[model samples]
Target: MQKVASKRWKLAEKIPPEIEQALSYYPAFFRQVLYNRGITSTEQAMAFLSPGEDFHDPMMLLNMAGVVERLLYAIDHHEPIAVYGDYDVDGVSATALLVETIQLLGGNVTAYIPNRFEEGYGLNIEALGHLREQGIRLVLTVDCGIRSLQEAEHARQIGLDLIISDHHHPLDEIPPANFVICPKQNGDEYPEKNLAGVGVAYKIAQALLRQRRKELPREGFGLDLVALGTVADVVPLTGENRLLVRAGLKELRRGGRTGLRSLAQAARLNLGALSTSDIGFGLAPRLNAAGRLESALASYQLLLERDIQQIGMLVQHLDDQNRERQKITTEMQKRAEELIQEEGFEEILFAFDESFNPGVVGLVAGKLTESYYRPAVVGHINGEYVRASCRSIPAFHITQALDACADLMVHHGGHALAAGFTIHRDRLAELKQRLAKIAFEQLGDLDLRPVLRADVEIPLGELHPEFLKYLYLLEPTGMDNPEVFFVSRNVRTSNARAIGADGKHLKFLVTDGWITYDAVAFRQGHWMEAGLPKEVDILYRFEMNTFNGRESLQLNVVDIKPAGGD
Candidate 1:
């Protein structure tokens, strides 16, 4: 069995006296939590906790006017448009949103998602040629094509109008599309720079809706899709994104879309009281499983399906695929670790095998990074080329490292912590060496242990049911905005035992001398092997768990250690 590594606990710094006083209207605990999120004044705290409905003007996005004008012209002229998209959730959601938006506006549009195994990611010349042959006069790309210089040129040569609306990091030489919408591009001043691809598509939808208010529905049209994609992409939930998600969650809980409503039921989720965590762990995985295993068109169709029977079939298919995906991921992670142990760990971990599924390699890379606390690259070596996905820690920028070795790669583009690339199998060794050099230069002296951060340190006795109200304010928390975690020391433990079917989870009772509370530690059943400690320190989230319609307060322990043991 693999030994559980010790984690470093880092308590958050206390708020400044002045800022704390500024936010004195709230309770001290709430004030501290707000201050931890960089909220200094009363106004910022209110806005952070309860975001407003007003969004940044969609017209602010660069080339928005041109793209809108061209799209409107296409709508007016009845030009056939193709919504070209990638296979992931972000891309699929963006594609669905844009396609639905255009279709609702009396435009003729169809979705064209690239196959993961056949066409790979992003825009491709063959797809553009096919679209042109099918008489698609205008092509609108979502979640991809920001770096498709060659594909954009091919579209121009084929006499197809192309508008690229993506949120990925763009290359120096932008794609020569008819119009481009990316906030990160030079001279673009859209305030929310960290939008997911679906967020970008939502902005375009907003722009179009502003022009055609007569056709607008009573409630927002695509906010549910926006929420699904935004949370799934794992972007920072701050600024405009937080506002979008807050509104989107409200929209999602309304259960307006039949497919989503059925999906929630199929996943055993309460659609009426959906939370961001529900979307991240429950909905996103099932939606993404379709693309990871087969084609993503099923997910897209499910999102737009209105028939109850069709929705049920699709949801059941996705659930089965997700289960299969989970099993494959476990096997792949075990193999990756074995390969790494045989060759020894390095600054950057690389595992490539022909047996690795192209769809699930990214998930394996993420798992490796979490287990070893280093940048990891997992790939599938096919006939002549290899496709790989990467995940990294904060200390090293994986995408920038890929950029430094751009000459060896056929294509690569992503954010700082996640990326993917394609390379010739012959040059794989050289690419690995170069990336290792870059990783060492950036991370040579850093201690690489995983650090678990807590918002505040308090005794277990201080937790109360009423405090849950304040915690609710931090709803839709993810990425940069995290949930509140508390560290309790020297808490007495009793009634400890392994609880899941596989005995992988721990259930116990914790007490701070006078007060006792039920606690559940997920994936920490290893501690039961040596008998439970009499007393231990725990870092956990205080939450209310509802089981069989009974609500009870519980500590969702994230990590635990023997008291005073380093």
Candidate 2:
């Protein structure tokens, strides 16, 4: 690891007086973090700390006018409309939100979530032909169809009207849909650009809500679905997104939706105090497991169903599926690592096997990318074609790299960080060479070491119960506004020992000259080389760890470096 020089924290010069005043309400160390993140003005800080739905204007999104107009026309004519969506949490939730919104608007609508194993992602031409045969006059796609140029043409050829509401990064050419509500579309002026797929669907719902002049249902109508999609899609939780998720989580905890309540019950989570972490780590993976292991339609049906017993049954099945997914993912990860070791890939790693499940390749690729901090691609040889998923670090854009090899791909689309594609089985080796060339060119002369961003630095003496209490104001942290990580130098370890049953976790008591604090380093067994240091520089986040009816402030250790001479 490269060593960074120690320097005193300097607040940004452009910090406004109001922000300084707000800093008076916080510790000086935290104030430094606010300044570093460009939250130097009181207005900016307040907005960042407390976001609301008012931050976004639905009208600002491109194609909103056209989408709303066409939807209203469909409602007026009572056209038979199909809500076509992908199978993941975002796709399912987007489909549920839009179907509910349109149904409330008196539109004849039915939802169709593509089967992961049979139909795959986005609009399949055969599915569109089937919908046409079913006499579906209009189709609205959510969370997909941004790059379905040929599929859209097929729909047009079959006399089916199509509207697309997607948030994926678009290619140079857009499909000829009646209206496209993708924020990435050309000339889109929406201020917030990084909306998840479900976020785009929520915007459409917002537009319809405004047009109808109806108050959002106070009984927790759409927020559950919103929360599911926002968390699962891993969109930045800032601005409008933060507001939606905050409100949605509130509704989720209040027990507004049967599906959410059942899911929480099945997962053994406390519905009364649900947090973003719970949603991301606990619920999302379970919901996504169905799509990955079996049928994403199970998740979609669970969210939309009104029957309580049915919801419970589906939750049980999802829980089981999630356990299975964990097993499969673990095995795939081991195999992927072995492949990398055997291949000795220095800068980029590419692995494929006929035995690899197409559904889990994306997850395996993500794990490999994080493990090595390199551009990683995992694919499954599916008969004549190879379905692949690609994940990249912050320094690389995987989708753009895939686009460069567009001629070699049958279909592909995704964001800069993650993407997926398909190629003829015979072309796998050539595609791997092409991808490695692109990665080498783009990553040349760039440092590939992982960065753990510390929000602030403080003496261990400053960590107190009162200070940890004040930190609660920064709850529900994820994506853009992450949990605050503080670095403390020259901290002496009073005691350290393995804590967990399998010795996977490490517990320690650390102290400065004036004060002592409890700390826990999860999954740090491998890092416990030699004896624990008496004094170390610790990077950690303050969290409330509860166990055995005890609630106390704890340092969640991120990284530890040997302390220099005091």
Predicted structure 2: clash tally: 0
lDDT per residue for candidate 1 within 297-398, as digits (tens), equals 999999889888888899999999999999999999989888777656467788999999999999999998888888999999999999999999988999
Local distance difference test values of all predictions, in order: 0.91, 0.82
Each prediction's TM-score against the native?
A: 0.98, 0.92
Model 2 stretches astray by more than 4 angstroms: 1-25, 499-501, 528-531
- Cα error of candidate 2 at position 113, Å: 1.2
Model 1: how far is 70 from its true place, Å?
Answer: 0.4
Predicted model with the maximum lDDT: 1
Q: Could you give the C-alpha RMSD of every candidate to the true structure, in order shown?
A: 1.3, 3.3
Return the lDDT, model 2, position 359: 88
**C-alpha lDDT of candidate 2 relative to the true structure:** 0.82
